[model samples]
Target: MPDFSKLYDDLKRARDEIKLKIHLGSKDAQDEWAELERRWATFENKAELERSAKDVSDAVKILGSELKDAFQRVRKAL
Candidate 1:
């Protein structure tokens, strides 16, 4: 199983950096950020309930991929 903490933290850091750099004035960017944040919380809740690192890692991977795409859109909007 991959390290959920490391993976999640890395993604979180990257997302945060992108968010900090962007104005987030566009509706798309705001929506994407909101979705990402919602998913982040859901993944954390799932990890807490399941107590399975692999499951958490998998969930985080999906979220990370979405976050990358979303951030790309946000970058384009900037």
Candidate 2:
């Protein structure tokens, strides 16, 4: 099993740090933040499902991949 907790924390920390540096008044920044929020929500929802999951479903596998991709994108953005 992967260490989802650590990935989640790292992505969140990166997002928060970037949030502090960007101007809220900028539409571009707000759009970027919105994308981050969307990714975070998806990742968090999947993580919750993973906790209660018995067998690893195809959907879960896809979600895991997506979350990892999102994390990488955010990391690169930072």
Candidate 3:
């Protein structure tokens, strides 16, 4: 059988990293929003692009979390 414990630990670490990146990205986005507003005084397509990018980033983080949870379950099963 596979080394499920090791797999779980690895997946958990990956999930943590994803979470950290998401947090950092969020802060960066806030800064970006401030800069955009200061420069333009109004919203525009760039904001939409940022939102879309953030959505994709969040989706990846969620997927990573789900994968880690699935791996943990499999580890338990094994």
Summarize candidate 3's per-residue lDDT along 1-78 as a digit string, tens digits.
146446645755765565555545777776764574465433334555666787899999999999999999999999
lDDT of 1 by residue, 1-78 (tens): 258667777877987897895675688888888898898889778766756666678999999999999999999999
Q: Name model 3 segments beyond 4 Å from true.
A: 1-43
Better of 1 and 2 by TM-score: 2
Clashing pairs in 1: none
Tens-digit lDDT string for candidate 2 (1-78): 567768877887987888787775589878887897898899888888886683557678999999999999999999
- Lowest lDDT block of 10, candidate 2: 50-59
> Which portions of model 2 show Cα errors greater than 4 Å?
54-78
What would the TM-scores of all predictions be?
A: 0.47, 0.51, 0.41
In model 1, what lDDT does residue 40 have?
Answer: 85
Q: How far does residue 50 in candidate 2 sit from its true spot (Å)?
A: 1.0
In candidate 3, how many clashes are counted? Answer: 0
Ordered list by lDDT, greatest first: 2, 1, 3
Whole-model Cα lDDT per candidate? 0.80, 0.81, 0.66
Off by over 4 Å in 1: 50-78
